[model samples]
Target: MTRIASYCIAASALFLLAPSAALAQEGEATPPPAPEGQAAAAAAPAAAPAQAAPAKAEPKEDLKDKPAPNSIYAEGLGAGLWYSINYERRVIDDLGVRVGFSYISIGATVSAGNSSSSASASLLTFPITASYLGVRSGKHALEVGGGVSVTYATAQASNSFGSSASGSGVGAYGSAMVGYRLHPVDGAGFNFRVGAMALIGPGFNVFGDDPTAFGVLPFGYISLGASF
Candidate 1:
């Protein structure tokens, strides 16, 4: 009976010690508590990512008022020291007006029945004409014009017949001309033209009689010009 009582006491002591051992193991397994501030920081939602400012668009350049397409032409011709200048203007496409001016002087000898006469003359003429542009295309054209002219002439003659004479006269003339023109593509390029002209005057000839000034006055010319 004494041995049995000692065994029961030992069993009771083991039961109390076993409970203390289990509680210590549980405490060791548990994590440490965080600070209040740290806990709040961890639980709060993350701040929204900062938005980027919109980029300012740069201002564009202002370009306006370009040049227009157009041209200016000048024409010129000459024979020896005598020369002419002409210009044409179009009031309507394919039809236009032409005007020109020239100066000339010549000396000649006339022989008739042993009477030899030395004659000299100087003349200035201005022609105003209206033209039709019959054919015009890319770089070439055909043109015709008819008009009147104004002339002023001075002449002096001395002959073996013992006669000397000097005279000055102003005359009106009827005239016609035709032309071929070449237009250049470049703004400052050379333009070319060729043409024939004839004239008739009602008064005494500026050169001589019989043949008359108009009889041998038909002439051809070549010109060079420029376009703007």
Candidate 2:
């Protein structure tokens, strides 16, 4: 019975010591499970990428100026043999007024059936008009207009038979015109106009009782002038 007790005690001690020796010889330990809080933090979804800010825009500038409406101009003019001086004033962008004076003189002698007659005629006309600008380009312009005129005229005649007569009168006139104006230097620069005009006046004599010399006259002009 004593031998059996001693053997049992030695067996229990060997079993405990054997486990400790095996652990020491292995030289490694099993890791514990991760904490719940640390695991949740690691598994959270990554933050989304940040968005960029938009850029600001810049403003634009104006390039040019609008002109004032009023302007004035004058020019030398001619149509056929008559020479004239022309004047114009624009009261608004598309509207204007003009005035001009034109003059012509001629002398002639006629002979037949043993008789001779010498005659001379002198004429003066003033044309007044209201115009519209139909075209407006940078430095070029076109216009059309119509108005009335006044004419003062005279004539003299003397035949070889010592017979002579003279006449003089003032008459009403009407006219229409189209003109193209050019500004060579700039918007308000040295300017000129090319135009066609027609004058119609009824028969009224100043020098004699016969009809006046200028009944229906058509003329052209190249005029030089300036404007402001």
Q: Global lDDT of each model? A: 0.66, 0.68
Candidates in order, TM-scores: namely 0.48, 0.53
Instruction: Give the best candidate by TM-score.
Output: 2
Write candidate 1's Cα lDDT for 34-87 as tens digits: 999999999999999999999999977322211112223333432211455666
Tens digits of per-residue lDDT, candidate 2, 19-109, equal: 8988876656655657998888888977899998887777653222222233444444433225566666666655777777778799999
The per-candidate count of clashes, in order, stands at 0, 7
- In order, what is each prediction's RMSD in angstroms? 14.5, 13.4
Candidate 2 colliding pairs, count: 7
**Candidate 1: clashing pairs of residues:** none
